[model samples]
Target: MTQTGASRNGLPVEVHHNALLQLLTNSLILSHTTPYLSCYDVLNLAATSRAFRYLVYHTPQVFRHVQLSNVKAAQFSIDGIDRGGETWRNVQVDENLTEDDFYSGPLRGIFSSLRRQNILQDVQILSLDGLSVTAELVHDILVDPSFSVRILSIRDVKNMNERKLRAALQYACRESRPEGTPRLRGLYVFGPKEPAPELLLKPPPPVPVRKAAIPAPPVAKAWNTRSKKALKVALVEAPEPWYARRGDQFPPRISSEWAFTLMACHGIIAFDTVLCTGPRHLNSPAWGTVNIDALNAADVPHYGVATHSLGGCASCGCAPEGWTVWGEDNLATSREPNERRTSGSAISEVGRFPLLAPPPVHSSNIKAAMCPTGQPVNPRSCFPSSTTGKREKACFIPRCFNCLRDRYCNGCHRWWCETCYTGPWATSPGGHGGASNTGADLLLGVWNELP
Candidate 1:
C-alpha cells in the first residue's frame, strides 16, 4: 500500500488523521457502491470533523463530476446540508464572477472558492455555466496539465458571443495544442440558461456561416414527403451493409455527440481529413472540430450518420493485434433496419452517454464498470479468453477505454459488444451473453475566461 501521508493537492499537511477510514472510503467509491454519492450525505460527513474534511475534499474522487453554480448562501442553507453555518452566511454574493476570483474574498463565488480551497484539484467532468467566461481562460484551462478536464460545458456564459466562441475553439485545435495536453475529448456549448422569464428556452444562436466548418443546414421540407423519399433510398441501398460500402461521400457512420476518434496513441482521427463530410450533429447541421459535435440524425445525405458501423470485430478482450477473425456482428445478414433488429447479435448494454466526460478510469476503476450490477456480467472479464483470465495483475487500455455505447477500441479499430467484454463467453461468439438494450450501467473537467 502507498505510504499514508499527504494528498496530491498538498493540503492539511502534518495533521493527524485516520488513514484506515480514508482507504475504506476510496475503496468503496471506486469498486463497490457507484459513481455518485448524495451531496447531502458527503457534506454532512464533511461537517463532522477536520480529519473528515480533508478526507472528503482532498480525496479528489468525490468531485469527479460536479456542478457549482453561483447561488446565494440562502439557497444552500435550505438544502439541509450543514456548511459550518457561519461560512455560508459570511460569503459574499456575485453573479458575474469569472475565473479571476479564485481566492478567499467577499466577492468570490463558489467556483472560485472551490479553486482556492483546492476542492477541484483533481476534478475531471466539470460544467461552469453562468459564469462570465473569456477565450484566453478556456485556452489556458484546457492546456494546463495540472487540471484533467476532459469534457467541459460553458453554457449561458455572459458575452460568449460568436467571436469569443470562435476564438475559444481555435485555441483547442490539434495544431495549437502544446506538449502534455490532457485527454480532452469533446466540448459542448448551449445558449444561456434562465435568460427569459416568460419566453420558451431556445437552442444556441447559430454560429456565423464564415466561422462554421460544415455546409449550411438543409432547408426543411414536408415530413411526409421526406420520410417516403428516405425509405425509398434506404431500400435501394439496403442490399449493401454499412461497413462494406466505401466512404465515397463521408466516413462510416459516427455520432455528432462524438467528434473525431481518439486514437490509442492520443492523436485525433479527424473525420473531415479523410472524408469529404464529417459526422452530423444530433440537432443542427453545424460541424465543428475542437468545438461542437451536433446534427440532426434523420434526413437525406444525413441518413445513418448518427450511429457507428457496428459488429466489425471483438474489441473487449485481448485478441491478436489484427482482428482478422470476424466477431458475431460481422456475420452475413440482411442490412435492413427492421429485419436486422431480429437477428442475433451482441447488443452492447447502454452505458454512459457519449456527451459527458468519463469518471477516473484507471485499470482499477474498470473492474467496477465491467461488472455493473452486483452480479457478474456476461463475458465475466476483459482478460483474453484462451487464457484462464487469472493473473495477479490485469492489463487494459489506459486512455480511450470507456463506456461508449459502441465498445470501440482505438488500438485495433474494433467494436467490443457487451457480450464479449462481460461475464463469460458462450461456446458461440457474439450469439449469447444475455445483454439487452438496458440492464448493465456504469457503475460510473476545466477551463478559464477571457478579457
Candidate 2:
C-alpha cells in the first residue's frame, strides 16, 4: 500500500485508520453509548469513508442494536385528474405499489441501507412493527447462528401467528453455554395473534421398572461403573430435569411463549412500554398471569402501550419529547434528530406527587427526561352540571390522556381550561340526563390510573 503521508486533518491516513480500528476493537456500544446514537451515527460515519463502512458492516466484532420503528414501504400512483372537465373526476392510471415491490422503502432509506450493506445481523432490537413480518423474516433476523438480537418488537404482520412466535422464541432462547441462558430477552408484538394453547405440556411418562434382573448392591454398582469407565465407552447421559426451568406446577400453563419471554428477561424498569405491557412480574416462575393481551391490538409496537396495572404507561415510551409544551406539529419538528430512545436506561425512580396538583416545574416539565405517567382520577366524574348561563370559551387545560377531560363534555364532548380545573365547565353532564359522578384527589395523578 502507498504510504499516504498526510490527509487533510494534518494526520496520516494510516494513523487515523489505526486509531479508529483500535477504538472499534473496543466496545463501540456500552450502557452509556446508546443504541439510538450509534445506529444514527454509523450512517454518518459510514458515509465519510469506504474503509469505515467496510469495517462497520463486515466486522463481526462491531455489533450494533438498531431500532426500526414505524417504517412503511412507499406507495406511489399516477392518476388522470380532469378537474376542468365535466365532473372533476379522478381515475387511476398505474398499478398500486405493493410490499414485494417496495418492502424496505422508508425512514430515509435506513431499512434498505441496512439490508444493502448486509448488516441486519447487527440489529439487536428489531422493531419492525409497521411491516408484514413473516416467519421467514423472523428467521432471517434472529434465528441465525451469528445473530445478536435480544428482544423483537412487531406490529400487525398478517402472515404471522402465535405458534410462529413461539417457534421463533424457542429458537431465540436456545443458547446453552451455561444452561437455560436465552439469547432473546423478550418479544413485543401488537397485532393479530393466534390463541396460544393454554395447555402446552404433554402428560408425564410412566415410571420405568427393572422387570427381569435384581438391582446390584451400591459397592457392586460402583465396581460395575468403574469397569465401564475402564472400557472407555461413551455413556448415555441422563436427561436434565424440566422442573428447573418449567417449574413443578401440577399443569404448567405459564410455560407458554408469553411466559417464556418473561422468564428469560432478568429485570425491567417500570417504564419499558414495549415489553412491560401489563403485570410483567420478573424473576419468579409464576408467569401464568402474563399473555399477548398485554400488548396493543390496533397500533404499532410502542404506539398503543396502555398504562400497565403494574405501574407503567404508554405516554412515557412512545410519545416524542417536548410533548406537553408544543403542539402536535411543533412536537414533530422538535424531536431529537437522534435515533429512537427506549426504556433501555430507565431506573426504578418515579414521582410521588398528588393528583390535580401539578409537579414542580423542575421535575415533571417536558424539557427534562419525562418520567411521569398518568394514573386514574378518582371517583371518575363526567362532571354533570345544571346552569343556564353564558358559556365560556374552550380553554387549554392540561388533563390526563387516559381521561381526555380536555376535549370531552356531556353536551358537545369538548372541554379545555388554560388554568382552571373546577371553574364552571363550559359544557357539563348535569344539564343533560346523566348520573352523578365525581373526580377524586388523585395521588401523583394515578392512570395510579393503570387499572
Provide the global lDDT of candidate 2 against the true structure.
Answer: 0.34
The 0-to-1 C-alpha lDDT of every candidate, in the order given, reads 0.36, 0.34
Best candidate according to TM-score: 1
TM-score of each: 0.36, 0.30
- Per-residue accuracy of model 2 over 324-441 as CA lDDT, tens digit each: 2210112121123222323232322111111111111112121122222221122122232477332221111112222222212333223321111221221342221121211222
Going through the candidates in the order shown, the clash numbers are 25, 20
> Residue by residue across 77-105, what tens digits does model 1's lDDT show?
32422333334334433443333322222
When summed lDDT is taken over every stretch of 10 residues in candidate 2, the lowest stretch is 350-359
